[model samples]
Target: MSTADVTSSTNDQKYEIAHLKLVPKRHIGRMIAAAIVLLILAAIVRAFSVGQIEWSYVRDFLFAPAILDGLKSTLIMTVAAMGLGIILGVVIAIMRVSGNPVLSSIAIGYVWIFRGAPALLQLMIWFNLALIFPTMGIPGLFEFRTVDIMTPFVAAMLGLGISQGAYTSEVVRSGLLSVDSGQYEAARAIGMTQFKMLRRIVLPQAMRVMVPPIGNEVIGMVKLTSLASVIQYSEILHNAQIIYFANTRVLELLLVACFWYLVVVTLLSIGQYYIERYFGRGSKSITASM
Candidate 1:
């Protein structure tokens, strides 16, 4: 090509490049949406701050002796119930996955019944079990009046633990199932007993998959303990109810309960994050490298 023609073509390209828009178009709609969201949030905050919710009562009763005692009860119940539930869940999960059909069927039935029933109803039933069975024990061996044994605490534990076990069994079973069949075969080839294999190999690996869901269940159990209040178990909600019933500071008392629940749930969530991180170390390292 001629020098003059090449120069003219280059000048035309430069002119076009200079005239072209560089920046992407602004999203006016998104900006408008964000403004709308911020306004709504501000409005909500203002409404709650000025609403009939007595903040003074919430502040005063937040750490009151009764509320603290109720909070303690809630924490204790949650821990006990979750612990018992985990133990029962492990056994039931094993049974569900076992070779024996009868064992599997029994586990299935337990899960079905407990998971299907309303937790509140289960609590009520346990609390009022004396009505159904005035006495409970081995006929010739020993006997006790149901009312004597099934106090609010016992009833709450039985109801929450048993019900939680049903959900936890499924969580555990899912985690167990996530393991590769080859892992089982390898353990067998190494002459490890099924129990040893589960304890040393399968469970450790499966826990990576299980920890998050189990953590969630633990948090859920904390909230579920509130339901025990229906049976006169003095959990946070029940204590709040009692206070409100006496003083008629219903919303404030409820806010107190809400505050404690959020605090507990937040702590549990933090713990769960650490647990998840610990279990996820191997996978995360590999992912990061990739």
Candidate 2:
């Protein structure tokens, strides 16, 4: 290009750049909203600090032996119930998607009944099951009193686990269906059996979809264990209730329970984040490349 033409282009670019003002926009409304929220939060904190609640009771009972035992029971029940739910969910999900009409129908019915009922009502039913069946055992090989066998723990676990299975089955089925049709066709083309395809190819892929909801369910299960308090299951809330009943410090005991619940849920949330990231690595890589 000629020197005159190059010089003219450079001069024009400089003129355009000079006229481009980079003014920052002011968020007046957002600033006002944030200020208002802070004020409300400060008021709440002040009120709680000045309230009649005996904070010492909360501190004292936070690590009490009874509370610790209750916390242990809560954790155990959560793990056991989730394990049962996951196993039942996998089987039910498989049955739901199977070609056999009878199996599919049974799975559908199971989900309908369990998921439709209130969890509290289900717990009540299980706790009181002995009224309907005074004796429960194998026909002749064994016989045991239903009341003796159906403790509060057993009733709570069965109610929570079975109800959780219904919800989890739907989550699993959705995860399985999220796999591409081509994946199934490709597996069959390679002479892979259905179960083998699922175990080796489908389930691994589906884990990415399944992990989130299942993690949420785990958190929900932790809170749901509190419902067992109604059945005299010695979970955290139940023990907290017992303490308050004796000491007449209801709010303080409740605060202690709340504190522990928040701690447990927070820890579980961090674990869920890492697990989701692990399962989502492939998707994240593909996204980054794009």
Candidate 3:
């Protein structure tokens, strides 16, 4: 190649790289502000706490068998509820976006009702449902009653998941919608079936948008799992509460639970950072504007 042509090509390549690397000012400012806010909050939390705590009691009691059991229960509920929430959210998102009016209405009403109610209240009601009815059975058929159908664990899952689904539906739907309509049209034009198109094309793309917020919810659910304590499900918080109640060290035990909660949330935030990086690949495209 001629010297002039080679020089032109190198300059064009450099220009292309720099153009595609444009960093928006708003994103930069927001990132700096967020970092500063987090640092300030951490410093403030470290500054407080006039109460004296028995360190040995905290160490022994916090990790005692009952607390461990409660931690296990907390983990079990967290996983189960989030799993159920994601599944239900996907279904509801589909229904809300479905072409059928009846299906959309049902999905919308469900989201509205559940999102409007507090999860704790919902949990309490489900646990008390058996008490209210005494015996639940088929209405038209022989009302042959069965045994206790719902335990506190079952009720807690149903209440927490069902309510969470209302919020997650919107998140999933937003993710699905983030994918360009052209992508769907292209999939159909190429003779892809609906299910395959979604699985192979759309969902992969939507997940790039979905995973972040879902991660946020997962972290939130880690704390929200504390509500199970109210139903006497013996989750981490409940176990801690038991210790403090016995020892009359409410603040200290409460601190332990807070510590664990903070640890779990921080771990999740780190996981989310890597997950975002994983989904973040080749989102750029050549356009006429370019």
Weakest 10 consecutive residues of candidate 2 by summed lDDT: 281-290
User: How accurate locally is residue 189 in candidate 2, as Cα lDDT from 0 to 100?
Assistant: 93
- How do all the candidates rank in terms of lDDT, highest first? 1, 2, 3
- lDDT for each residue of candidate 2 in 36-120, tens digit (9 for 90 to 100): 9999999999999999978888889999999989899999999988888999999999999999999999999999999999999
Of the two candidates 1 and 3, the one with more favorable lDDT, higher being better, is 1
Q: What's the C-alpha lDDT at position 188 in model 3?
A: 97
Winner on TM-score between 2 and 3 is 2
Rank the models by TM-score, top first: 1, 2, 3
TM-score leader? 1
What are the models' TM-scores?
0.92, 0.91, 0.78
Q: Cα-based RMSD of the predictions, in order?
A: 2.7, 4.5, 10.4
lDDT string, candidate 1, 142-217, tens digits:
9999999999999999899999999999999999999999999999999999899999889988899899999999
Model 2 regions lying over 4 Å from their true place: 1-21, 285-290
Q: Locate the minimum summed-lDDT window of 10 residues in model 1.
A: 281-290
Question: 1-290 in candidate 3: lDDT tens per residue?
Answer: 99999999999888886546676557888899999999999887666533366666667666778777877788799899999999999999999998999999999999999999999999999888866677777777655322266676888899999998998999999999999999999999999999999998898899989999999999989889899889888799988988778879887788778877887788889989888766766555323225
lDDT of each: 0.94, 0.93, 0.85
